[model samples]
Target: MTAARPGSREPGDQEQPGGGAGAAGAPRVPAPRGGRAPGPAAPGPGTVPAVRRGTAPRQRTGRERTGGRPGAAPGPEGDGRLTHQELMSLLGVWALDACSVQEAACVEAHLNDCARCADEALRLRDAVTLLGPPRSLDLDPQLRHGVLESALARRPAVRPVPGWAAPYDAEAARLDALLHDINADEWDIPVRVRWFAGEERAGRSLTVAQVLDHLVAMDGLLARAVGLPDPLGADAPADPLERTETRWRLVTAAGGDSGPARLVAARAWEEWREQSRELVRTAARRGGRTGEEMLPVSVCDPGIFPGLGAAAGPRIPLSDAYLNRAFACWTHAGDIADAVDYPYEAPLGAHLRLLVDLTARRLPGSIAGRRRAGLATTRARLTTAGAPGRTVHLEIEGAGGGDYWIPLDSPTAAVTRVAARDAVAQVALADVEFCRLAAGRQSPAEAAVAGQGDQAAISDVLSALTALSRL
Candidate 1:
């Protein structure tokens, strides 16, 4: 959907619901120490037992015999009582500290039915187990000592660029070049109609025209932040006839047809292209780092900007800005490409993967503690389509002897295999969807289910990711 134009009235700014950077009542949890826990063992033969709260494990008719190993606790007995799944969740927290193989198996069986529990179990496993091998690196001791001493000696000053800030200059240039290549004839339509009128995909609704508007506004803001004269009129008269009148002066500078809104939109497009090119040139000459490195970078609360303002922050690291902006551009470009019936061509997926890995490795201790419990490994088949004709035999293993095989390269379609652990939670959604959810625009449940093959696993991953994001 098209974003409201700059300077337009917005909804009352409210903190995003649920906890994260800008959420209300978010808790401060400790960082996780290592990697994730192991997978769960597979349930062998017959119908897997269905466990629910208030149902006694023993008293139910047609219940399978609990062939639990020796020294195993008796399964719950009675209606409306804790079922195998509930008990596993309870034990999942403690699995890292100590849990028997049989206990893990029982929990895995329960997880097959409960998505939430499965997700939790996977998180706990990551926290307690998945420690990567320690790396040994050689460094100059004197340099290290000097850097530390310098850090301790003085507080670093946050400085603004002497001229216009040049954050994202390269990207801006690329965008300008791309816009120039598109037919000038096509620029004369409403951005929404041009980009998203008939698109039917999750991320494709925001059209290129909408994206242009956003970029123009953003560039203006960035320029203002660095003490540059606003290239587009900062105080132009609002045009009553414009679709979005807040930035009317700037929009009007770009000529369009007199009667039809389409003509206005086309003129706006041309203006945006020219202004964007100028901004990129100005940005390139300015000696500034990425937006993230700009200390005290001001951002409004997402409550003010609908989907855009939730994760605002000041002087965020350059890496973070690059990640956020890259994701935004890439995902939206994917949408535009889809709308235009073109192949998607973006390289941000690798960067996204890196972000996930970093976030996973640095989860807080409280969240990590949860993952440590009852961790096991299992093998399952994985498949992906990006790679051509290559099949990878993935070994999935976890706490309860959970093992399966996956064709890592051809995982476009979900394939069912014998798995006690919810594979989807452990691998896919947990690492990515959680961050997006915390940033707003998605429900925890929705993120959990995104691209998930195993609902139970997705739930577990969601819980862990939610917990981690809060931390």
Candidate 2:
């Protein structure tokens, strides 16, 4: 840990010297115990930087300071100031060059204003630098070939992400990058997947390979719906769930011999990626499918989990279908990361904003059906949820985000601008958290909703959003 610079000690830690009147008749107090000499008087301006005296550096909040938790209100300084904890938490990541642009900026800004933080960041950076590169070791020629094969096996056919789908695409690409160096043995590491059913956490567990197999199965449906070739052979079942389970069995069984199994998984994954690339390219060629080109695209029955698109679900534009596919790819990538114990970062800003926008548009109607079936006074329940007010302010922060006023009374809420004061509830969520909540992968109880104003109205909106999708 970095030591504080001279004069940066807390007031309590500074020696308060006391001394009897000296021969010159100057009054002074004696020095405090601990054999410390009297501290020097504050330096004149320009001689030394001013020490910011006051409260003990704010106690660390939670495990580490973040740029504020997803929904916690920002300090009066807004998001510019990094708390001590925030700076500390960011130090290691920044040193490793693994931090996002926003996070890096926060640390840099905090370092400028805080000598303690700056010193600490320097110490950490130096330690990292001293570690240097790993000692070189001769590798077996066969081992090198296997590693290269594994890395290439994970590479999907690359393509430029369309403007609206950039975040989703970038996130998927990140997951692909994560698999590059994983050991063969780590492929089977399993992770528990959970979702809130009312208040209980429930969902299946999956291994890295199994999760990729599932993506291969699910995205195959998206590919077909968007008029791309089926990644799996024609023998697969028509029902997506049945097909998924059936293909999962085949893919997993084929890999019974680990070497052969990896090849099987790799082939399926590559085909899916290639088809995904084609799907996007096709959509782009059609001028991105605006207006009339944006038509209802029902691919399969709604009963099947991650059926990809619903037969009876509302008709969405063609661009949304691609975005939805991207969401699926990126989300499962998160699952793979959890299994392998790698840190996963989702794309932020515009890409994530698009998904948030999609969820906001669907919120009202998703609740309307349940409202009619469950409540005797449907109008009252709807009003309590603030649907009558017609709009809720969603403050989705970090990456692919903006202040959105989502309409609560209709199934399709066009992107309308509404003032902060006019919203029924000002709900705040991080980009990934909101996407997970909207996708039905996370329930409200499982997700924290940071908000101001009508608590009931916020709860109402969240409850309606709890299970918007089955996958």
Candidate 3:
């Protein structure tokens, strides 16, 4: 007879003289180490005593054990064997090498016998191949620098962000990154948005997801102007205040206005990202054209703040509107940062300068608007942009900043550069602080660091800056 191979069992190795045989002539086999027994088939639990012969089992937690037993199959209760559903659920962990040794043995044995499980196991193992290997959390420090350098290289005629739209693009991208990184639970965290409305400190409370809902409604206006669909449907109110309310109501009805509003946030987030991308693409199509149109989109209504005329708000250029969108994005991003206790930097120098310039240019209108509502000292001394007029030497200090002699009376007046000494008063401010003031995040009382000249003009200009802020 041919010699039995190494580790092979002899005929009747696991068979007792009495019974316990599997199939015709083949023994119910698992010849255990150094055993000599002729005993009855086990009838109950522990009757077939647990024999652990391998290395000591690792410290076990829930549903964990070491090696599988030899010859000891499950009793009537199928004790120690996992359910089909349980085994299926373990496929991922098993693929990842996370399953305990006993569980691995169980999974392997079951996969061989059950075609369905075997198919799933094959697929899972194939997927695990794509996982490669475990990696360390520590990343190369220059990875971000390399990636950004790659993405920022200007591909002319392709995704070219116009100079005016860069701030909006950057801020939108920053906010999108923040949203992508946050967990579902963070969506429910409360955020309070403050702005100067009706000539007073006005504020409202909303969850983070609700905040995104608000953003979608507001940004949808720019989307509409650019011929993109609004997140809040076509019939949505043109007025921002009403639009915001309408958005919140819809979110509430959808069962996403409250605790852990992950669905709402996710929907709004998708819309925001898509809309932002579309906007950038549309701007790219403009090819440096200002697309200057009378966008009556009231970011801050002349009626909202008291003294402004019954006349509609500024007929801001579309380029200016893009800048406004960027400003709002940056401001709200800061709100999100506060909610999550994250630190975020302000816009870059060029972008910040443009933002500040826009806000400064609009200040004259805000002051005039506030005056009509009796908020500022009405100055009838109209200054012409062509000829010399009452100009504040608005010294914006820091990057993206330049000296601006903004006319106090009218938005139409030409801003002729005047000698520094010829200025009525010089209001010097850190560039970012001025932006915060315009965003209504800071009060006029604390917004200015040093003001020398007409305190009244300074106060009026400062207060009017906040008037630029809206819901």
| Candidate 2, superposed: residue stretches over 4 Å from native | 1-161, 196-200, 232-240, 250-264, 290-292, 295-297, 300-313, 373-390, 409-422, 439-443, 446-448
Give the per-residue lDDT of model 1 (tens digit) for 153-180. 6864243221122223333433444454
Model 1, C-alpha of 113: deviation from truth (Å) = 81
Question: Over all chains combined, what TM-score does candidate 1 have?
Answer: 0.34
Score residue 235 of candidate 3 by CA lDDT: 84
Q: Better model by lDDT, 1 or 2? A: 2
Ranking by lDDT: 3, 2, 1
TM-scores, one per candidate: 0.34, 0.56, 0.64
Write the number of the candidate with greater TM-score, choosing between 2 and 3: 3
Q: By TM-score, who's the top model here?
A: 3
Across 1-471, the per-residue lDDT of candidate 3 in tens digits comes to: 010112221101443221243234321222112232444544121111112122233333324553326422232355756778887887666655566556655655555445566556555644654555443322232344356557776443455667767678778887887777677677777788988875688888777776777778888888887788888898888788888889888877977655447776777788678888888888887756665655654533433233333343435577778888888888998888788766667676767878877766666666666766777763667544444456667778998566666556654444543433466777889999999888888887777568888877777777777787776
For candidate 2, give the lDDT: 0.53
Candidate lDDT scores, in order, read: 0.35, 0.53, 0.64
